[model samples]
Target chain A: MKVVALAGGVGGAKMADGLARVLPAEDLTIIVNTGDDFNHFGLRICPDLDTVCYTLAGLANSLTGWGRSEETWNALDSIRRLGGPDWFQLGDKDLGTHLERTRRLSQGEPLSKIVRDFSHSWGIAPLVLPMSDQPVETWVETQEMGWLPFQEYFVAQQCQPRVKKFAFKGVEQSLPAPGVLDALEQADCLVICPSNPWVSIAPILNVPGIKESCEGICVRVAVSPIVGGKAIKGPAAKMYEELGIAPSVLAVAESYRGLIDGLVIDAVDNSCRDELEAMGIHVLVTKTVMQDYIDRMNLAKETLEFCQKLMLYKGRQ
Target chain B: MKVVALAGGVGGAKMADGLARVLPAEDLTIIVNTGDDFNHFGLRICPDLDTVCYTLAGLANSLTGWGRSEETWNALDSIRRLGGPDWFQLGDKDLGTHLERTRRLSQGEPLSKIVRDFSHSWGIAPLVLPMSDQPVETWVETQEMGWLPFQEYFVAQQCQPRVKKFAFKGVEQSLPAPGVLDALEQADCLVICPSNPWVSIAPILNVPGIKESCEGICVRVAVSPIVGGKAIKGPAAKMYEELGIAPSVLAVAESYRGLIDGLVIDAVDNSCRDELEAMGIHVLVTKTVMQDYIDRMNLAKETLEFCQKLMLYKGRQ
Candidate 1:
């Protein structure tokens, strides 16, 4: 069965990794958010895409859930001492991606082509696509800074930007890249890979024509990033609470009401299953903590079975 | 006694180093060639300027006459693994300059300010300014590549191209940076360091208003990059031969004939004193080979004394 997953950084990468492990390489297509891409020291840093790419290539630092394992920071430290902004951490080995990507982009190569070529170089098999070809930066509308780039708000500010809301700059101008529509069109299922609802998935859905494409054919499903008012990683839980949401699965379901067919939450948050089901959304509760390879595969198996059974029930009816 | 020294790379850096040791920090201003600057791995690299800066900071590699003394190439090797072009040999420590300069430039800081900041950061007190504010890339019109950027032609292509001529792209648009004119105007003596006559000094002179600003000012002099029909360091002699020059001090002198007031040669090439004198140029013969600290200081003393003699002669006339 063909499957398309939209993802952001570490947490989404982990889920994407789970899907890649469970499904055939030909069946899985991952669409990464490129909103964090920015030129720093002339290097084009694509944080989310790199997280997914490295995770798939087994090059990611599993402990940190970002950058390459065994990476050095000699370059970064030297750069810092030279008085460049050291807020956003770039590992030395990981810097190769930014360097090559920046160079290629400066030479008129598109981000899509660079990512595809880089994925090929890294020996990643599954199809990986950027959400949009044009710039669609996720800007945080903070009370202090007024508007901060997603990384500056999320990373540099350490998510301390009392975020009132988010603004996806250039989203109106962005279009879903070529393979994204095709991937959704051909897929048996569209999975929003447990990424941040407002920032990650919203940016993907914000792309013009993408929502229509996802709504047309695919059995769209979402794995809830929130379980028991907690995120698996990153600032999602804090962001949800700061945005006046209770940081719960029900809040996530509300956030993605029209977009998803099934909502996958952890067994720990099983109490909210009926509440979500009451809202006419199919709910699947399982061990969603991807602590090990087995956890990923098991969760992937359960989700696939849930989608398969739901489709079968609909077919019979 | 303010001084402005025009320089290229290694040989220029050596002379600049000698002068830097002898002169007061604020008195000596070294204007280095940015013609050798190139974008590698998305970072702006100023090769000639970096060589001068590192040498003056006492951080220069003794063997290579360029780059940082204690250096590591782990980043370059890592970049190679990531399938990047590591051909230009970017060391970890040297990356500090590129990163800082790039960061500052991206923030709309001028190259002159960045160079001064970099010099101060590295504990080099004397001023070092790029020859121009705007980029004036040196392109070698080669028989093979037609025209290649200076670094590509020099480092990547290994200078294999049959030299036709040179082009200083964007030179017409370039302006001599802030301190350049003032340094030239206020100087008691001007020393043209033993950098490449064609590639280095030519680029400096090619800057708009720089040549006119320095002409007929104080005691303008140059040290020999060529002695016994050979360059002390780098491809000056080879480049001279390829460009159809005889690779002698006379050819070197002829290149700078209109721009300089006096010439300095080693005692070894003293036989050609009459030839240089025939051109109506004052010549100084000295032990120019800077084998150690004493040799460098002695050469600096000779250059200074030569400048004094030129001023005295001019007074007599």
Candidate 2:
């Protein structure tokens, strides 16, 4: 089946990688969130786009799930020695992406075009598209820090600030990048990978026409980022708790509510399936924590199969 | 005596390092050529300023006479892998300097202030300053390439292009950086380090009032970059030949003309001393090719002593 996956960073990149593994190159397109994109040390840095690209190209550090495998930090270490900011943890190999991207961007090339060219250079088969050509920064409103830019909240502050809400600046004006609408139109199913609902998927969905396009798809399934009352990674669960909502599979499903035709929950959250089905959403309980390449592939396989079942069920209805 | 040195890249930096070794930190100030500075892969790279700073800080690669001593090439290597330009050969540690400088420049910090802060951070004792806070890019007019930026001519093309002339784009309008004029005003003598006359020392002198300010000083001595009719390092001799002048101490002396009171030439070119003296300029023959720390110190000492003798002669005259 033709699949288009919406992704953020690590978890989303893992899910996208899983789909890339199982599907033909021509049949898969991954739309990555660019809301987390920021300029670090005067270089354009797109965290989620790079993560998805690196993961798909098989260059990602398996242990960290971000940055390149065997990456060096001579540049960052040197910057630190010179008393420059070192909070971002830029890797030498990963910095190449930012440097080249910044150069091209300054030369007036769009981010999407740079990502496309880089993917081709890295020998990546699957198409990786950023959510928008225009920037949409994710600003987080926190209890102590007020409003912090995404990277400061996520990386520098280590996500310790109590979350209030997220504002995706520029999302209202951002159009889906070239091929994004076409990919959604051609896809048999849209997979919302297990990324943070607020910062990651929200920014992509909030783009002017993206949600409407996804709504037109026959099958739309979301893999829960939260499992067993905590995020498999990142601050997704903590963000949920701070925003006055219980962090659970049901909360995740409810967040996607009318847009998603099916929800893929972890086995640990299987108890919420009956309630989710009662609310008119089809539910699939499976192992959602992707520990390795094999786990990613298996979960991807199950998610796609669930999409097929949901599409058939909708047709019968 | 308080000494101010005009410098460019390797040769100049070596001379500055030698001066730094012998003089107390408070006694020396090095004004570096920023004409060779350019934006590489979106980073503001200052070749001469960095070379002087690195040499003074004891971080320069002794073998290459540029870059960090224990530099890593992961960033540049990775950029090459992605089909990005590798012509500039930016080392990882070197990139940190560019990155931070670029960041600070973007934040509206003056280049001189940033250099001062960086010099202090690197434990460099002597004051290091760029010729101008405003950019003064050296564009080389070549027979083959028409016009190429300084680094493009020097590093990227390996200086093979036949030089016709040079244009310091902003030099006519640029003022000497904050401390540059004050440094010259306070100096007992100004020593033009053994760097390229066309691109290096000329650019610094071209900064509107800099040469005029030096004219007010009692002693102004320049060390010839040529020895045995060849440059000790870099494209100085080749450039002199291309510009229709035989590469010799006499040609170098003529290039400086009335601006300098004395010329320090290599012992191999002592034959030209009388001819240079005929032009009303005193000449000192010494071992001007600095190969190591001792060579740099000895050359610096000789250049300063030559200035003292010229000052004494001027007093008697």
Candidate 3:
């Protein structure tokens, strides 16, 4: 089946990698969130886009789940010694990507074009697209501080500030990046990778026509980022708690309600499956946590099968 | 005696380093050429300023006469792999300097301020200043190519293109950087380091009041970059030949003309002493080729003593 995946960083990258393993190059398109993209040291840094690209290219550091494997911090260390910002860790190899991207962006090339060129250079088969070519900044409103830019909150502050709400600057004006609508139109299913609902996937979905396009798809499956009351990674669960929602599979399903027809929950959250079905959403409970490459593939296989079942069920009805 | 040094890159840096060894930090000020500065990978790279700073800080790679010692090339290597520009070599440590400098420049900080802060971090005690706070790009007019930016000619084109002339884009509008005039005013002498007169020292002198300020100083001595009819390093000799001047101590003396009171030439050019003296310029012949630290120090010592003698001679007259 033709699949278009929406992804953020780490968890999303793992899920996207799984889908790439199962599908042919021509059949998969991964739309990465650019809301987290920011300029550091005068270079454009796309955290989620790089994570997805590097993970699929097998150049990602497995330990950090970000940056390149076997990376050095000579540049960052030097910046620190020079008294420049050292809060955000930028590895030398990863800096190569940022420097090139920033150079191209400053030359007036679009973000999507840069990502396509980088993916080709990286030997990545699956087509990777940033959510939009235009600049979209994700700003977080925190109780401690009035409002913090996404990276300042996520990386520098280590997510210590309680998030009041999240805002995607420029999202209202941004059109879906080229091929985004077409990919959604051609896809049999849309997989929302296990990324944060508020920041990662929200920014992509809120991009003008993306949500409406996804709504037209026959089957839309969302893998829960939260499992057993905590996020598998990042501050997704904490963000949920701060936003006044109990972090759970039900909350994840409700957040993506109306758009996603099927919810993929972890075995630990199977108790919520009956309630999800009662609320008119198809449910699939499996080992949703991806510990390794094998786990990613298995979860991907089951998710696609679930999508197939949901498609058939919708057609019969 | 308080000394002010005019410098550019490799040869200039070596001379500056030698001076730094002999003079106390409070007594020496090095004004570096910023004409070769350019933006690469979105970072402002001040080649001449960085070379002088790194050399003084003891962080310079002695063999290459540029960049940091024991540096890694992960960032540049990665940029190459990504099909980005890799013509100019930027070491990881060097990139940190560019990145921070670029960041500060974007935030409206002056180039001199950034250099001062960097020098402090590098433990360099001598004051380092760029020729101007405003950019003064050195563009080369070549026979092969009509016009190229200084770095495009020097680094990217490897200085192979036959020299026609040079144009400093903003030199007409740029004022001498803060402290430049003051350094000249209070100086016992001004030592023009053995750097390219065309690109390096020329750019500094062209900064409106700089050359005029130097003229007011009693002792103005220039070390000849040309030795044995060849440049000690870089494209100085080729440039002189291209400009229809035979590369020799006589050519070097005439290039400075009335601006320099004395000329320091290599021992091989001792025969030209009478000719230089006839032009009303005192001459000093010494082992001017600095192959090591001791040579640099020896050369610096002799040059300073030569300046002292010229000062004493002027006092007697």
TM-score of chain B of each: 0.97, 0.98, 0.99
Query: For residues A193-281, could you state the per-residue lDDT of candidate 2 as single tens digits?
Result: 99999999999999999999999999999999999999999999999899999999889988999899899999999889899899888
Candidate 2 off by > 4 Å? none
Candidate 3 per-residue lDDT over residues B1-317, each given as its tens digit: 99999999999999999999999989999999999999788788999999999999999999999999999999999899899999999899999899999999999999999999999999999999999999999999999998999999998899999999999999999999999999999999999999999999999999999999999998999999999999988999999999999999899888899899999999999989999999999999999999999999999999999999998999999
Interface RMSD values for all candidates:
2.0, 1.0, 0.8
- Global lDDT scores for all candidate models: 0.85, 0.91, 0.94
Superposed on all Cα atoms, model 1 deviates from the true structure by an RMSD in Å of: 2.8
DockQ of candidate 1 is 0.47
True-structure lDDT of candidate 2 = 0.91
Chain A TM-scores, per candidate, are 0.97, 0.99, 0.99
Residue lDDT tens for model 2, B198-297:
9999999999989988888788888888999999789999998899999998888898888788888888998898899899888888888888889988
Q: How many clashing residue pairs, candidate 3?
A: 0
Top-DockQ structure, candidate number: 3
| Tens digit per residue, CA lDDT, model 1, A155-267 | 88888877898888998988888788988889888888888888888888889888888887547788999877899887888988888878999999999888887899998
Candidate 1 is scored at a TM of 0.91
